[model samples]
Target: MLPAEFDYAAPASLDEALALLAGGTNIRILAGGQSLLPTLKLRLDRPDLVVDLRKVPELSYIREEDGEIAIGALTTYADLVASDLIDSGVARCLAEAAASVGDLQVRNLGTIGGSLSHADPAADIPAAALALDASLVARSEEGDRTISAGDFFHGLWATALKPSELLREIRFRMPANGGGAYEKLRQAASGFALVGAAAVAEMDGGTIEAMRVALTGVSSGPFRLHALEDRLVGETLSEELVREACDKAGEAIESPLSDAHASAEYRVAMAGVTARRAILRAAGQWR
Candidate 1:
């Protein structure tokens, strides 16, 4: 299927892009077009203008600043996977998730911001970002506002972003004394996750100090299992404990979706299995 006819503009500067968006009511910003083009082709979305951000130089860099890592909104998954600045456990998990999105071609063309903005419950980045405690910086005619990953995702295919706002960058505190991993079950054809888990753990003197667990593909949005986090912290990091924690985490999730590929019960079971595996991998329990 072909996308509907629409005006296209590749803006070289942020101001130009912002102005283009502000000038039109039915305008969609195109980052890599990996997600948008398909939606457009399917006629799920129709815009009067497609504002391309590929020519915006400043929105494509990855850098470390202060105590956090800052990734530009337009940075591709391939760029994240190849970046040297991303060295910590959180970074590794995020990079792995990026690599796992679709395929090599999609990774090279898909932007992190695009993935987040699309807000697909099955997308890996939102869960990974939640585990990393990432924050999004959005800009608009009014000003800039920072949104935590927890608050950024509102519901199925929905986000906190206003029509006039543009995502500028993502920021997250660097992980230390910890490691992370993301585990997912993918659809054989599309490679999108049917169920995914992202885990981060910090160890202090053989005891778990801090941990985060997030799940995707089973809910309206990526969600963190805080009840499970509380149970795991201050406990000895062991297979038994991890298994129990995973079970509790699965139980804590409110109503996961039952789709054609998997039932709600199956997704919940897979969520527990993946959570345990991810936690073990992040804790170096797997060799």
Candidate 2:
């Protein structure tokens, strides 16, 4: 089906885009058109105006500054996969997640900002964002504000972004020492994750100094396994300890999603399976 009739504007500057957003109600910002176009075609969202940011060349970039990697809102998944800077540690988790998104076409066009803003429960990036301890910058007519990844996603398809705000950039700090990995079970048809997990582990000698484990596609929103992380910190790194802690992976999920692709019970079980694999891989324990 064709998209509903709407006014369109391709703004070359972010300020211009912000001005357009501030002046209109029922406005949608278009980055890569990966998510929004399909929604528009389905009439799931009919807006008064669609502000396309494709012409805003400044918003598409990847750079590192002051110990953090800053990714522009319009940076494509393909860009992430190709960047040499994102090859290790927490950043690698984000890169791996990007590599796993849909197919080549989607990866080529889908923006990281667009994926996070859409906040789809089955999206691959949110889990990595959570594991990497990312901070998202939201731009509005008023100014810019940074929101932690933990506080960003409110629920299924819902986020902290105000209607007038656009996600401007995503930031991830370089870990002092650690490795990270993303693991997922994809649905056969859509390539959307059935259950995805991202894990980062910082080791001090043989002890686990700190660790983070997050899950997506199993709950209303991607979330960290804080309890599991808390249990592993300061403990001696061992296959047994990581495996045992991961067994409680689904314990914190109060409402696991149930759908035709997989049952709630199956998701709950796979949560542990994916979490274990991700944690082991991040810790360099996986063979």
Candidate 3:
């Protein structure tokens, strides 16, 4: 499990990190080393240089701003779980998803930014981010750009982040009055999502006002249940309606990944099941 010999740089500041990245694509950014180390051990990623960001103290905070929550790219899963910001509302789904990542060890070591940037279809964070309609902040020598969570994901193990850029932070508007849930069918060994779903909904007098449903592990990337969410608006919460909407949960998947752990069909089926569970729980607390 030894990685190939490569040059390593642990930059002390974001500017230094950006400078190194500007040098070339052969340089990989290391945040938490949670995903990068595994890829290196597998020899799946070959890089001439590895730039570590752990030493950069600036990119590791979670705070509130103007009715929104700003999450640093370096924030770990354990941080998400412990933050008071996640006790209720839309952020609750993110907290639950973070809590379900691997075990306590992985949660302690894994950064939310690394997990999202890795763009693993089976990973938990992206689904919750999508459900919350978060935006990603990416910085480079050229300038800074804010990308919507919907626009950040491209495909399996892919993201819109340019090689010369570093993801600086993630931001989402705080929900005023709402409820949400994250439900997953977990793989036995890895604890990664076999099929996971996150739902956030707001109610206006027992009728659905705004809602989002995003699914992971059944698609090439996390995505919202657009049609289902649209159908839910103005509709009163009902078991039949919830089931009917969630039945189309896997329809957005373009190309699904299948392995020994679970087949594509099983993932698709469980996506529907978990989505139903998530939306039902979200609906339950809307009152």
lDDT of 2 by residue, 40-129 (tens): 999999999999999998888999999899999999999999998887776888888999999999999999999999999999999999
- Model 3 over residues 68-91: C-alpha lDDT tens digits? 889999999999999988757888
lDDT of each: 0.87, 0.92, 0.88
Please give the lDDT score at residue 92 for candidate 3. 86
- Give the TM-score ranking, best first: 2, 1, 3
Question: Model 2, residue 3: displacement in angstroms?
Answer: 1.3
Q: Residues 1-287, candidate 1: write the lDDT tens digits.
A: 99999999999998888888788689898998888999999999999999999999989989889968999999999998898666466666788788789998999999999999999999999988998889999988777899999899998899999888889999987757778888999978888888899888888867988888899988888999898889889998899988877875667667888878878888888889988888888777875
Q: Which residue pairs clash in candidate 2?
A: none
**Superposition error at 36 for model 1 (Å):** 0.5
Q: Candidate 1, clashing residue pairs?
A: none
Residue-pair clashes per candidate? 0, 0, 0
In TM-score terms, which candidate is top? 2
Candidate 1 global CA lDDT score: 0.87
> How high a TM-score does candidate 2 get?
0.98
At residue 190, candidate 3 shows an lDDT of: 90
